[model samples]
Target: MAFEPRQTSVGGNIRQAGERLFAIVEGALEEEREQLALWVPVAMGMGIVAWFLLPNRLEWLGFCCFSLAMAAGGMLLPAGGRVRQAIVLGGILACVGCVLVWGKAMAWGTPPLPRAAFMEVTGEVRSVSAIPAQQMSRMLVRPIDAPALPRQIRVNIAQKDVPEGLGEGAIVRFRARLMPPAPPSLPGGYDFARRAYFQGIGATGRALKPVKVLRPSTSAPPLRARLFAHITGRVEGPGAGIAAALATGDQGAIAEEDAEAMRRSGLAHLLSISGLHVTALIGAVIFLLMRVMALSRRAALDWPLMLIAAAGGALAGIGYTLLTGAEVPTVRSCVAALLVLGGLALGRDAITLRLVAAGAVVVLIFWPEALVGPSFQMSFAAVIALVALSEHPRFRAFAAARDEHWLRRVGRSLGAMLLTGFAVELVLAPIALLHFHKAGMLGAFANLLAIPLTTFVVMPLEAMALLLDIGGLGAPFWWLTARSLDLLLVIAHGVSASPWAVMMTPTLPTGVFAAAILGGLWCLLWRSWWRWAGLIPIAAGVAVMSMASPPDILVTSDGRHVAVRASTGGMALLRAGAGDYVRDMMAESAGFDGEMSALADLPEARCSDDLCAVRLDVNGRAWRLLLTRSDMLIDKAALQDDCASADIVVSDRRLPPWCRPRWLKADRRLLWRTGGLAIDLNQGRISGTKIASDAHPWIVPAVRNRKARSGNQL
Candidate 1:
């Protein structure tokens, strides 16, 4: 059908165009945005750090391709020389990266597949998780499990008394977990397991059981290592564990409950060495350094104090990130600090949205994986929102009305907390459902409760406590920091008690997610007043969430367990002692409330002294089936009316010699039937292979192999 052009209101059309323009401008602001806009580079820088951390060769090749394209484009860009130089420099770095990866690949046949198991690993108390530094003394053990041992085992020891001077390189012996490190899921998702594989850690353990420290093990280091460790020990006192964690990010003391609280509240980022922490630290350090430099002539003008401080902060940020497991978040912070410093060195006006954005793009080109991580997504979402808001008339009005009064400051904090909490939650909610199958509603509130305490109270106290430790005064600060940490924990507990704290759920369709984002862009980017687009995600969230239809019938690791949710909403679950993964998936995909209702006990349908058998009258058909941990068999109880009625049997046992119409897994929700009867699976989809435990799900959708459809998209 030929579509006719309908006249639309000028205002409405303008709004649409304006939003597209806003998305473009906000994205372009990477070149520069007043104040916080330069965060794009920060995001990008972190991505580069992630790129360097991986042991993959394909990604290196991809990184090279992206760098070359970006470098070529930079020359033609109307941006500043510095921007162009960074791009070119990135390309040069890419070449070096290619060489390095090439060497590693050549040496190891491939980048290095993850290890199956590490034998008899023997190591020491290299690092520990802390509560708040200068507080209660505790350390986590990443026990050594070497490759020579037939099996990996984890050994934990919590010491009651320790020499105050015992430091790093404290040797110990033990077994580690024999985990077959989980492989990568998506192209660019974080791979801590793989990273651990390279780090020689086979298992993680807590210092639960007390182990006698034979003596302080001895080890020497390069000048840099010793200096860094000395500084680390001085700042992160032996006692103030959480303080050390704040500085170094070893979260051993962040009890599981505390960690869960932070995660649920969405305030976990505050404790980590993410951008917020680094920015605050950089600002503090620059102010301190400039003041100090003002006192000396050579240091003042000769060193370009701001530039020097930025550089110094960058180094310190990177160092801190390394201590905090050198994970993705820290890497991003370090990248941001360096980019900000680079801006200072060039005498650029200020870090702009466009510049940082360009940096982020560059980073993504090199490490596409960052695009999928929650940290990267949330950090960028917040940055972009803030940048867009900065350019809006309403924000300017609000800022003019209330600059910095105490009440205004509190209001601003409240406002920022509200905005950040909601923005991050909303942005990542869809993906959160896909991953953990839960939506923490009060996460923002949790963060609000925790962040201030962390920034103003915990971090500061921890830093001070670290200094005290190297000196003899660590014990005094430990008490105060511990108390502060406790208060933070208390706040988390209070907030988490709320009924809306979390919602366990399933993922939304991709189409809906896209619509929500587009709708959000309307409110976030193009703004004069709130409009229709802004309401998309909210309305979609409510409508679609309310209308979601979950499947029934769950199968477990053992074929013996079968959970079926009938059409009447009645659930029948076979008593399977271990069905954690199956139960979790169901709980995640089906609403927690639904799961609560859908759970039912299953008494054995049949037991036999001779041939083990179970019988079920399903969909008006009499079928006798053999149920074993391995497989199953199906037959018509009577040969006459039900011969064509009974569907093919599913089992770990070999396929029947008869019809091969289809097979399915017990876990799958899909249902099938023979001839005229559509055997309603009261549950859901089940594939032939799934039930048989012989093939992959993808093979079904791809029923026709490549040979049959060589030229087809299929």
Candidate 2:
């Protein structure tokens, strides 16, 4: 009874504190409920990103059951229980996102391909694009009789492999070896198979016989495809391919060296029809329409001038999206543009963070799988940073310096451009490093020289050329467009040659990368001073990334290539295959930024026609690794030598157990099942991640034994 007074004092103190906190929050939100509602969609997007990162896809029945339960619970809640109601509403929205993703996955399911010696593929050509870099043409075909396959199959036909008169809607038949989409080149890497599943491509193959056209349809090809064909045909210069890429979002024809140069120089984003391009196009439309409206002020006065501009801008964005086949990035940008334009029409805040969040919500609701793409991540990161910077007092002051002297206006404009570039880099660099292990070091300067040219010159000229082509006066405009592209290419090449053009770093841990993203969002979206707290997580991410280490060894998914860290600091390859795709992936995965051929020769390696033996010294201790073909493993003398000397034996076949007790054998069986291996010599461990851990229904199980793979198409 004596302690009752203390308990009463504690309860009274807690009650008073809670009341004060509630009053403060209520005051803050009194007039901002509508603005705060914008975050609901952003939260929904967060849930979608989380859903895609799940190890296994959600089952439809389970999702539906849970969603129904959540909805019923929310509906049953009393009106006075605001906190409980908010919790239930958030749960329902998250569950809705998960269910929508599951539905999309179900819609993408297709019948499996038959395992036969020769697949007689007969299909109508849906589209054809050339990869001049690889001397190959990709044909998307709609199979007629291949019931065991998806509706479409992508066939890679080399110049020497097939006859050349392929066009859209032309029926063609060829003999080919159909194989499943290539799996991720490394464990825990991007799943090309999962992407293919969403793209409705069940199989890929190389044409073995000449493509024989059975019939040609009367319908015209897609506008984007026709535009690509026209650009490739009419323009005959180094810049022609880039013009097509810029106009139609098709970069397959660009030279490999040029593409690499653009990537290194940070100009690659311009090559794609991304957000900047869309914004420029919309701005151009608005400016042109406003000029025309100025000539007729009476009509402009009758209608809201800004509404007309917004409507025209929205139309331009939509047209551009359709012209680019509504690619993921374009779709995302278009949604954002439409949202802001719609807000303008409704007389709302069109440039707020809420508008951005609203756009993200729309895109995720329609195409949630895009949450896993690097483009989506980078695009949103840049947008969030730019928007946040624009809201700062200094930036607003700088932007408001338009009434000053002409030279001052020009200086302010230049400063704004510089600040925009720097802010975008600050936000996007971490994402690029986390995914690609490299940041565009010369990106700011490159954008300064490149963006104005592309926006004011190249894109405008391309649009004019399109308009002129309809009037039979396109040749000069096309030439002007090509010249502008050539100048941009010159800038890209020159900047790429700089010593500090690319900053290569090791990969960040997944947790740290996610934390950085959340921190950026929190800083941008929060309205109070507490937003400054986000800086802690951002700093932590930087510290962790600085300390991260690259993998010491990388193995190809097929066991055909293996790279080990050499004493000279570059990766030494076991073999160089006909195609460098897998080898490049391995090099990038291990954070080897130099040319692949720069790998130092192994002086400690002994080589024969069938096998090579090398000594691996990690730290001060030496270990032996043997690389051998399946046939060579049958030789008893060489096998005994390998078993006696090697700490680890690597082969494409299972060998007899004649090794020392300490020796570790990496045989074909393990590699086949796991896809690849990344070893950490410093930690004396290997990453245990397996391909199956992130497997989807589209990925068929890997054959476990030699007998199962005897006649299988891998």
Top-TM-score candidate index? 2
RMSD of model 1 against the true structure: 10.5
Question: Which candidate tops lDDT?
Answer: 2
The segments of candidate 1 whose C-alpha lies over 4 angstroms from its true place after superposition are: 1-245, 295-304, 342-352, 400-409, 509-546, 556-576, 579-586, 593-714
Q: What does candidate 1's lDDT look like per residue over 494-523, in tens digits?
A: 766677777754334545654565566556
| Reference-based TM-score of each model | 0.60, 0.89
Candidate 2: C-alpha lDDT: 0.74
lDDT per residue as tens, model 2, 1-714: 775667449788998898787566555544444556655765566456555665465443455456558767777744544444455666677777776776787776553343423678889988877776578888989999766767888888886665645678789998888877766766456677667877888788888767787886566667887888788776667788888888889998788778888998988888888888889989888889888887896967786878899899998899989988787778878888888888878988777776667667777878787777788788777887888889888899888755778988888888898889888888888888777778888888899989999888888888888888897898998888888888888999999999888877654567898888778776777667766778999999988877777777676666667787877777777774425666657766776777664222577677666777777787788877777743643568757876777777667666576744144566665565566677776777665334344435565644323324543422
